[model samples]
Target: MKKITLLSLLAAFVISCADKSQAPGAAPVPLLPVATVTNENTITDSEYPASIQGKVDVEIRPQVSGNLDRVLVDEGAYVSKGQTLFKINERPFREQLNNALASLHGAEAALINAQLEVDKLTPLVQNKVVSDYQLKLAKSSYRIAASNIEQSKAMVASAKINLGYTNVTAPVSGYIGRLPKKQGSLVSASDMEPLTTLSDVHEVVAYFSLSETDFINFKSHYAGKTIGDKINHLPPVSLILADNNAYPQKGKIDMVDGQFDKTTGAITLRATFPNANGTLRSGNTGKIRLGINHDNAILVPQSATVEMQDKIFVFTLNKENKVSKMPITVIGKSGVNYLISEGVKSGDQIVLSGIDKLQEGQLIQPEKSAPKVAQIINKK
Candidate 1:
């Protein structure tokens, strides 16, 4: 209690001295640290959540119905194009092929018999031993037998194709994903679940979406008027892995979706990154970082600015050294500074400290100092 009273009396004595001094001249000036507005190139970064995938993501499905006899490739194995991955039971297919071959042989034999009959009737007709009508019947029979043989040949070809399908080969060069079906599992052509998945991860693509407003802003920041020029001139992007570690390799934005999705109101973009070490894979979640550079950008230390009722303000000293709070338009931020678009120009003097106690048009002592925003909390 005594300390509080003593402090209040000291404050009153200081106020009395200030009032007497002001009565003679003006008011007591508040000492403030100031920094000059700087203009330089600044880069702003934006991060969007992204999903990573390989260049080719394919579901391994069976083309023929059969019991899985062998799984040649283990899960997550690297496979070359046309490499055998699975083998289904070929016994059933081979039996069907034998049946088709037998039918085809029977038809061929019938065709031979019909041809003999036609030959016999042809000579008989010439000798007048059989009627010409009988010869015509024999010729028709021969044509029917030929048609039957052709039909049976088609069946044999189809069976052969099915038998070949028993050995499933990798259609592309990639790494195998999860193996859902085990050996001896009855897999069919119409099965709901795929046998496995294959992903070519040599180069991975990170897909991210941009909101319509963000997309427009991004396009406007580039140097070109056309979309192609903007894309071609775009800077490389970086990837943040799921664990928040930065990916070692940088990526380039090469593809954009045709249009915005109606339901999501966002446009998709793809960035390709090299996975030479085969670290990236399909279905990985990450973030994509995009950088935008601004030339001759005006930057203000955040400590020099004050926010009042959601508007940002900074105290500028006029020629008379009187401080006046002025509003500044903050377009973006880089580290500890706000990139002001308007309301503050280059070479303006801004107060860096004691902002909470400042009033508009207050006369004060201006001290030129280079105090960073991060160091303000440690100031005396």
Candidate 2:
């Protein structure tokens, strides 16, 4: 009985040893999608909040103080240069002009009388009918009368200018704004509020700002010796209206603020767009879309990257299919891919999935596939 039990135990031990030796050599290395990094040309858009203004924005105000007698143009009406926009009470101005004319006539009559006296005295003095002192005094009186006539003429001209001011005219071709003062309302040159505002919308300007860092990046992308040169070389930009619709006409960057705002630490830029149809107006809000082109740029899918400790990393495979976690410097984003400036270069293989389960130096079965190159043109 003891010998049979020993045989059974020996058979069990042999089976256990065979099972241990046959165990799966090791869990098959995880298989994950792999993509090759490639260099391609693409354009990415960056948007900045902007404020729109007309090419010529002017405040319409009264030059002369008087009661508003008529408002000729309605609010939001288009006007041309020299068109009459409003009429102040002209009766008072006309009366002042008449008074000036009467004074001028009176002065003219006095000048004629003075001239007659000077003529009479000149002959008398030459004939010895009066002393030379009397002639000199008459000549002085004539000079004073002539001076008075000149002064009266100046007064008449001044009155005419004031009368002309009664009819307020448009200074430029533009659209009229609100008419705060109605007919019969008193308006003056010193009034706190302007009568209205005029905006020449034949073309519109959009003003946007960029932070200090963004400005530096923007400068690096373009090739120019000066800001003005950069502006001239810059490609046309697009305007996105408040409703998120792109403005039909593209705009050009024409101006850059001379200095950064001390408070905001940002620099302002101006882009001008043609508004032949008057689609854009003053006080309109929008965004400026600036496109940056990249040539031979290395792009990587965002999904293949993992962010740790505020740094982005990717799993790159070596010749032996061993993956090593590598850090990449991202310059910008295009659709679902990232624009890589540093790190892995062209022909580099990167693991596309299951990155969370990957260790620093893990073996991966790279299921080779084409990398996703984002849409060539992307807007943000």
Candidate 3:
């Protein structure tokens, strides 16, 4: 009787423990943060490769051909307008001027001799001591001498002008480029390469290209009947330097190409930026960031999305608190959030954290608080 009671008690204890272990709700659902999708207005940036150029880029070339006597400015030097940039050998030009002056003197002396002969012949012809033809010939000679003096004077003036060309001066105030021709090197007005280049960097222009489709989309986003009107209403843009840093100043779109390139089908556009500090230079490269605004756009945090086979998906919560993996159509990205066009709507809840561990049809206990979509959109 004692063994039977002990065995029955032990079996009862074992059954009690098994029943407790198999009770319903023994395992708790995972508690994950969830957020409701909302419609918000936001702006996204589009970057395009751009090439920088100064507002005034001019190639400095000689106006006359001669040996370079002196290079007044060094490479990368800043110069002012009317500053002498180079000096050519002036000996040849000086000699030419002297020759012209000597010719003028000779013509004047001839005029004096002709005038004397005409005076003597006119008196003799009046007295009938010689024929009138002698006086006429002497007058003609005097007239020819006077004409020669005028021609010689013109030659002297031209020589003076040519002499002035020997001193090359800057046409504008800017920084100088390379000095390809050294002292004593022969340079000409028709040389294929310029002596140097001057760039006015107080203002800079960035040139970038856009494809045909991009151009059409760009025009449709603005509220204007013409491109010029659209540009007037457009907001200022930013420049990203080669080092991936944003430029301190903002720029405005000022020009657009009239036609697209037939081979590349891309249209070029220009944006001007102020560089009062001389931070930017010609031949520098960067990217132009253009902002586009979207209204009533659906936004989702990137943390809640996952990529699989080149497609993005988010875990959405149903009425029963069950999570379903749904694909979203992402139009663009603003800051840490993506602008969604489809797959989720307002009032829809999505898993905000630990999305990697989530599986389809999984039950989750959503937290009461949600992320601020407006704050995220404005972070851009």
Q: Relative to the true structure, how large is the alpha-carbon lDDT of every model? A: 0.88, 0.89, 0.92
lDDT comparing candidate 1 with the true structure: 0.88
Q: Rank the candidates by lDDT, best first.
A: 3, 2, 1
Query: Between prediction 1 and prediction 2, which has the larger lDDT?
Result: 2
Winner by TM-score between candidate 2 and candidate 1? 2
Question: Tens digits of per-residue lDDT for model 3 on 208-286?
Answer: 9999988998898888899999989889999999999999999999998999999999999999999999999999999
Best by lDDT: 3
**What's the CA RMSD for each of the models?**
7.8, 4.7, 3.4
The ten-residue window of minimal lDDT in model 1 covers: 371-380
Residue 299 in model 3: lDDT: 85
Candidate 1 per-residue lDDT, tens place, 317-359, comes to: 8888888989889988775778889887878878888988877
Between candidates 1 and 3, which one is better according to lDDT? 3
Kindly list the per-residue Cα lDDT of model 2 for residues 1-380, writing each as its tens digit. Answer: 99999999999999999999988787788888887777888776789999999999999889899999999999999999999999999899899999999999998898898888889899889999899998888888889888998999999999999999999999999999998999999999999999999999999999999999989988888889999888888999999998899999999999999999999999999999999998888999999999888899888878889999999999999999899999999988766778899989988888877998899888888775544333322322
- In order of listing, the candidates' clash counts read 0, 0, 0
TM-score per candidate, chains pooled = 0.77, 0.81, 0.86
Error of 1 at 174 (Å): 1.9
User: What's the lDDT of the predicted structure labeled candidate 3?
Assistant: 0.92
Rank candidates, TM-score, best first. 3, 2, 1
